[model samples]
Target: MLPVVNNLTLKNYSHLANSDEVSFDVVIPSLPGFGFSSPTPKNWTIDDTARVFNTLMQEVLGYDTYAVHGSDWGAFIGWSLYNSYPKSVRATHMALFPELPLQPEQLEAENITLSKEDAFSEQLWVDNSVGGSAYAVQQRTKPNTIGLALYDNPVGQLAWIAEKYISWSDPRRGTGPSVLNDHEILRVVSLYYLTQSFISAAYIYNQNPSSFAIPLSKAKTDAPFLFSNFKYDTFFIPEQIIRPLTNLVYYKSWDFGGHFCGLDNPPALVQGLREIKKYWHY
Candidate 1:
């Protein structure tokens, strides 16, 4: 079973969705403020999101033990879920792991390929930090100001997110606007629009009140994990960072594709899921 943003539905794992090969039921619930689920009364944090999911799993789903797989924002949710109920979650697979301090070897590796452009790009975020922090400055600090402006205006939102999706996927590459298919990107974003979570989603920037906010911690999960990296991704995490964190069940380094592998390269995404199912059965 999987929890998903409202509006965007989960199609069963391609080949295995309806096949007799895998009998386990796959459930994808709409998250609060995104789909059928109700919007949260207050700005929600990753911890708060995890708590709701835990309740849904234990009380509604009636599952005492299960596996978890998360990608994008879902990756953080899965981590929080695993931490909150270690005994219940048997294994977890996160496609994008969170930020973490570089090991000595990692720093050495990062230093080896510091091209002029890379250095300039790295320097831009050096002061504020990477990924979430930069995003927080915009979303947490000035949400309403931005949200009021973007609401109902779809084109603005599309371009705003599209650039990041394209840039972060691999800005260096001459990839067009987005790697993911147009439809999939809209499907994911529509959840926010339909549920009026646009402001709420932005609000998550401010309410980062939880242990999960940190990059590294002693709070570890016994569940195994897997990561698939497309070499062109804007944010490349060295194997060194991932290998130490979990039971790395699988790692595939593809020569092509970007951050949105599922959209950019559907066949590859399908194959990846197939491989995971095989591993799950094995």
Candidate 2:
């Protein structure tokens, strides 16, 4: 993965590790302010994260070109990376579309009705102070306070992150049963707790520009992209939101899985990747 803003680690990528067909070396770096990575000198936004990731890929990793995959914040960074360095990204895929909205007409044409799930997501956007991120509300409005609380309390960190993971996953997709194994969820959760990366990961929300207003960064991405739709993610991107973006050749809708599809539905996740690979040479 590019850098994990969340508490997740390379070890959590066991799904990829066990795949015999995919022979890929993984590089899991902690984003600045997360894990072992040093904190940024000052507050950083998504753009800053993208710039730092670009440098990591080009100068630090000496990677001229590479394929990238992202979930949650990772997906945001991946899109930004592709936007910032199109030539450097061979191919990119994301499990969920961010909070970017579509034109009113587009939303209407799709007949996209906001279901109860969508309403929940909308509330998150509406309630957000600067824009739409519960984490951002906490971070931007009160960073030091929240950070200090979670700094040493391991339980606080787990609860904060676990809630996100649970909420981000689609509740309709049998979140409590069929979709993701509790052991699997706990594995990733434990990783976060052990690392004490909760506050740092949550800080990503605070640092990034609020989602109430979409950033101009969307225009920066021109590389091949995939938007894997899950039943219940933190935000719902009706097909209309995605239709306008050019260079998006692959769009797959999963009957199962949620925001964290890579973990909740690995088989489906792998299938999505395989389909993308059919066209994307990487």
Judge candidate 2 at residue 75 and give its lDDT.
Answer: 70
Evaluated against the true structure, the overall lDDT of model 1 is: 0.58
lDDT of 1 by residue, 164-222 (tens): 66654534333433335556557666755666667666665566534334665533666
**Which lDDT value does model 2 have at 234?**
46
Model 1 / residue 150 / CA error / Å: 0.9
lDDT of 1 at 97: 64
Off by over 4 Å in 1: 1-24, 100-106, 109-136, 170-179, 186-189, 209-213, 270-282
Candidate 2: the clashing residue pairs are none
Q: Determine which window of 10 residues in candidate 2 has minimal summed lDDT.
A: 1-10
Lowest lDDT 10-residue stretch of candidate 1: 1-10
Summarize candidate 2's per-residue lDDT along 150-259 as a digit string, tens digits.
77876776676677677666665434334455565666667666666666666676667564457433445566777777665545565556656647778776666666
